[model samples]
Target: MCDAAETRPGIDPDRLSFTIALQTAADQIVNASNITGSDRGIAKAVLADPLPARRPRISARKVKCPMSRYGTTPHETRPLTSRSLTHLDITVLAAAEQPAVLPPSPANTDRRSRVFRLLAAADPGQDWTARQIADALEIGHLRSLSAQMGQWITQKFLVREGRGRYRLHPQWAKTPGDSLDSTTTIPA
Candidate 1:
């Protein structure tokens, strides 16, 4: 029975109806105690019916919409309609064309420097929680700020007043523009 269901050379096994019949037979044999004689007869009858032919695989790719229908060709030019421009429109266009003046970047704009400046500018006695400092500096993640704070504590740049709270070290608690050392300092 297994030899009769064997796929011939160059023939696809999935296209053979005997493959499905063999699988059903194997299943019935494995559950022999559960499957009754009537169940076996029903399986035989179902397998006797002719199987539908499998459709050939489609090789062409499908597109949402054809490009030619909606798009214009390189040679196609849209007709320009001439209209008088109002005084307000001319003023608005001129203003938009002019380059916007942006504020100059701070000299010490690094994360550590910014944190140092913010903490030093505050009251020396005040203790800032991580959340408050993050909110003030617009920092998204507390973990990053916490890690930086840890490093600062080790460097003696910041002092941890309590849990989740930190303040600038007493030695570094000077006004902005006052130099702490030659290496690290708050910019004016």
Candidate 2:
């Protein structure tokens, strides 16, 4: 029931608005119906049947751990000073700290990278098989690697000495692409 005594006698808009709102909220709670479903449903859930949830006795700072975030045992790191170290361990650690120079593009994206790595690993004047290149690079698509050889063929980047074998063309590597121009990136 609206507080009629609280309502002003004449042309009282504010009390009427409050009366309407109180009735709307109570009506929604009884139906468990989301009238306008914004904050109303949450308020309905709370007020309709006010029940307490069982929460564990825990604090934020105490729960802040790497294992807690990942929920894994293996990832839990020990304090650095607690561990014992050897001379080789120190050397390996120092070497690991130095950043490795990665190849320019994404490692497994382009076939050119896999081909280059395979060629670099091969002996001075020896040719590498398409399967061998695929195996060496741990790449699944041997056909794509074979297709890359064809690209090298069209570009004249390497001499495809027939039947899937490619040898580095010394002349192509040495010659610059641009005519009398500087700041041009020549093909490697």
Best by lDDT: 1
Model 1 residue 41 distance off true place after TM-score fit, in angstroms: 20
Q: Candidate 1 on 70-147: residue-level lDDT in tens?
A: 233344343333335465533444445768889897667777887887887788889999899999999999999899
Q: Against the unseen true structure, what C-alpha lDDT does each candidate score? A: 0.66, 0.52
The numbered model that scores best in TM-score is: 1
Q: After superposition, how far is residue 188 of candidate 2 from its true place, in Å?
A: 8.6
lDDT of 1: 0.66
Cα deviation in Å at residue 160, candidate 1?
0.8
